[model samples]
Target: MGIRSVLSKPLAKWVVERQREWMYRPAEAQQRWMQRLIKGGQNTVFGRDHRLTDVRTVEEFRQAVPVRDYEDLKPYIEQILNGDSDVLWKGKPLYLAKTSGTTSGTKYIPITRDSIPNHIDSARDALLNYIHETGNGAFLDGKLIFLSGSPELDQKAGIHVGRLSGIANHHVPGYLRTNQLPSYETNVIDDWETKLERIIDETIDQPMSLISGIPPWVQMYFDRIQERTGKKIKDVFPDFSVFVYGGVNFEPYRAKLFDSIGKRIDSIETYPASEGFIAFQDSQTEEGLLMLLDSGIFFEFIAADEYFSDNPRRLTIDEVELNKNYAVIINNNAGLWGYSIGDTVKFVSRDPYRLLVTGRIKHFISAFGEHVIGEEVEKALTDAMSKHPETEVVEFTVAPMVSPAEGLPYHEWLVEFATPPHNPAQFARDVDTRLTQLNVYYDDLITGSILQPLRLTSLPRGAFQQYMKSLGKLGGQNKVPRLSNDRKIADGLMGVVSGK
Candidate 1:
């Protein structure tokens, strides 16, 4: 082993032990973070406006500040954008993470000096935890590539402005700098296709050991590699051992990704957003991500079913129940007060507070009052794939067919197959059956003749990619939504159905 690899084992153990201090006492850790955030916000404009100084408990803080989305917090964010200090946090933010917004055109989330560590350290801890558990740190000796956005940043209100991944590039620790791949020049290429080609060129011959990115983009990179060399990713990078991904669920793409790699490898899932790094998978055997209790962010959960209701109950860590979906709300040192990032999660293990990202608050199929979440659809499709091992899915989305020309309106599933199922009709039936079992309301609707069984529309290979390319969202953290309440995506997908 190299010098860094020899040293990594001890460092990984130390880091894992330190994480256990907060992981085991999640409620207490969360309380301390809440106090710290409140103290930091006390002198800021948002804190004063929300009566943060007077807040003594979680309930008091909840009462003082109502849960808000980006639009609700935009006024304070505008002050920061106009070069105002002590507006949200105590001073001007260290960085403004630029992100695409649906209702709002664009959003700039603050990343304060205190909050930046949460992003940087959490990712490090995830890898360290893996090394500690598996006793494999040799990956550190080889090149590690992160498929990310352009690191070249712009300035706004005297604060550096860029994508979250771009901002994170500046914070990669000195120890890993030598091992990180894709030269700065290659990383700064604005066009994803051009950047990807350059990345393949730069690292195609290197001893790549670890690769991290959103799964679809990584899959695309693997596809490009195969196209160039006619070899599996594992053949190209024999030392490759770990895959780190976030921004979307990995299960749907798992079979296809592993097929490209030609083997199963250790993979880590992370729950990160422009606002904060919330959680990361700590154990390979664990079912969910270990929620970061001491990461400068205090979390609250509102039951997903009750999220749209007025006066939704905001429960703290100690009060959350297992296997129940909740919309996550966060108050952090970064100046976000009761901000809703619109993500929904379910606790799989409460002793250590491990959660699965169930879906987005806004991304669901409830056009017929049968609210089907991302988790259910994913599970349904996964179960079907398990039964039919011959099939492999590339990408898919579900939308309500509210007004069909034929019989009863039903749910429409647009699926792009990497390898078509041997028995496509039976595969669709299996998915539909599993979905009904997972969602009772959907079963009831079908039983009552309110809706027909889901209709499968086999999309031409690369159809979804083409759709995203048309919208200028083909790569780098952009992903197709798993499902939508409306047919905006489904209707747009119709144009690409010609080839199939």
Candidate 2:
């Protein structure tokens, strides 16, 4: 037997046992989790203010703490930043994960000492579950590469502040440290291009068995690796068996990644955010991720349609249904209470709870009342890509053109193509047709001539790269928002493309 086979047997058994417990007693698990989270933070300012100590039931907890967006929770975060202790959690946070903000400039999300172990354990379990399900423990025998953010962190009021991935790098177990690729020196490099080059140099000849990263950066790495070696990735790393991805939907990048590898490779998707490691793909036979019921995060779901209502319904694990989109609300050990992470998800299974991330709550186009979301646009693009097997989307974003003087307002797509379709206009038409089929309001608008057909703007090569560079968010978990309600991002993209 291989070294991995011996070493992973215990881990595999543990994962299987925990998974069984979660499957058989999901409701009980969630209830116990809720109690733990509330009791753990009850001594903190936030918990006391929300009457967590007196609250024993989920309903009482819900009634006490209202769902809050980033704006609502800013004051508490400011208190934490100003060197306050026991503000949110029982103790001070170990790190503040700095993330790119939407309306605000930058957000410093708390990462408490208690929450760090949960993040590490949950991430480990995601891979362990894959190994248990697939009986592919030999992957652990070889090196693994994690395309993460720079590990170099900044200190803010005695708390380390950096990207989540960077913070995660520091907590990698000592056992796995030797097996991880791209030495610590390479991982600390901030510039993506330089970092990628150094990673390629370090890992090109290693016994690479696994790779993990967000799809775009991973794709870039694969391209460069293939370019340098003049061989398929599979050839470069003969032992490569799996490619793990998270943070973005894999459908758009799936075909290209496997094609570059030159064979089918197992892939696991995860729904991990800076706030918490929420869900992970546990079963290859299943369609969606199995919700981690005991992972130190308490989840509540609000139906997307009801989210903006005066009094939206809050649904727990027991109440959620299959195939319904929900805005995810989380209360975790990190001391965030009823915080809306702004991502939307749809349950694919109820027993043991599996879900697919649908889209970002704020990332959508509602101009002319069509109400198109990231899911619809991504699906539309996927369908369009399906019709043209030769084409590949390197990067893309969609936005609305409102009140155009010359023509009826239409949705604008700025796409940077790695491989252009034989018929670009046909591809655009296919996208529009797919959108009309998926969204009733969009169909009505098109039928009634209230909006013109979507305008396709084929961006010159490297347009997205230039735009990202301009924004100073060139790589490492930074991605182009798929859809924008207004033309600002699209206009910025056009200006970069045209160099005007």
Candidate 3:
């Protein structure tokens, strides 16, 4: 038997045991985690203010603490930044993850020592579980390339600050580091173009078996590797067997990515964010990712329809039902209270809970009351692009055109295509038809003549990448918002195209 198979057999069993325990007793597990979190922080400022010491039950906890976004916690976070300890957690955060903010310039999310294990352990568990389910552990015998951001960190008030990818890379297991690609010096390079070029030059001939990263950046790497080697990824690395991806939905990029790889391979999706590592694909047969119950995060669900209401009903893991879209709220070991992370998801299974991310709560368009969302637009585009087998969508974004002075309101799509469709107008019509079918409100608006069909503007090649570069958000966890209520991003995209 192969050494990898023998080594992985025991790990697979352990992972399965842990997974089953959580699946069978999720409520019990969650209850324990919540109690631990509250007890650990009972003496902190946030805890005492929210009556954490007196709160013994979920009901009491809910009644005492209110749902909050980043703004609500900014003051405490600021206190932490200014060298205060025990303001939110029991001690000062070991580091902070700096990410793009929705309402502000940048957001610094706390990462405590207690929370660090959740990130590392959960990431390890994902791979172990995938091996358990698929019996595909041979990849462990070869090098694994992580297309990640620079690991060079900055200091703020004695706490390290950097992208989550960089922070997580720092915590990669020592044994795995032996087989990981891209030297530390290469990884710490700040410029993406320079870093990518160095990475391609360094690892183009290595016997790589696994590749992991966000879809967009990974796609770029795949393109570069193919261009350099004049071969498909599978041809270059015959044992290339797995792809681990997160940070965005993979539906739109799936076909193109597989085409570049030149064969079907095992894929695992993870729902990880700057806030927390939420879920990962556990069972290969299932459609949705299995929610990580043992992780330090206590989860709460608010129905999407009621999220903006004055008092939205919050349901625990025990009470949430199947197939309902819910805005995810989390209270985690990282010292985030009842925080709304702005993500919306829908349950695809109930027994061993699993869910698919539907959209972002704030990323939607309702300028003319059509109430279109990210999922609707992505699904519409996927369906539209499916009709034309010869073409593929590289990157795109949609926004509402609410120019009353010019004409009636319509949707504008700025698309950058690697391979343009034969008929852009017909492609636009197909997208509109799919949107009309998916969203009844959008259908009504179109039929009622209140809104015209969504217009498609085929952007010059590399327009989206140029726009991202212009914003200094060119790579590493930065994705263009797919749907926006206002035309600010749309206008910016047009400006980029015009400049080109």
Q: Which candidate's TM-score is highest?
A: 1
TM-score of each: 0.98, 0.97, 0.97
1 or 3, greater by TM-score: 1
**lDDT for model 2, on a 0 to 1 scale?**
0.89
Query: Which pairs of residues collide in candidate 1?
Result: none
Candidate 2 per-residue lDDT over residues 119-231, each given as its tens digit: 88888888888888888888888899999998899998899999999999998888788899889999898788898999999999998999999998898899999989899
Q: Order of all candidates by lDDT, from best down to worst?
A: 1, 2, 3
Off by over 4 Å in 2: none
Candidate 3 per-residue C-alpha lDDT over 399-443 given as tens digits, one digit per residue, 9 for 90 to 100? 888874666789999887778789988989999999999889999
The positional error of residue 180 in candidate 1, measured at the CA in angstroms, is 1.0
For candidate 1, write residues 220-321 as lDDT tens digits.
Answer: 999999999999999999999999999887888899999999999999889889899999999999799999989899999999999999889999999999
User: With candidate 2 superimposed using the best TM-score fit, by how many Å does residue 330's alpha carbon deviate from the native?
Assistant: 0.4
Ranking of all predicted structures according to TM-score, beginning with the best and ending with the worst? 1, 2, 3
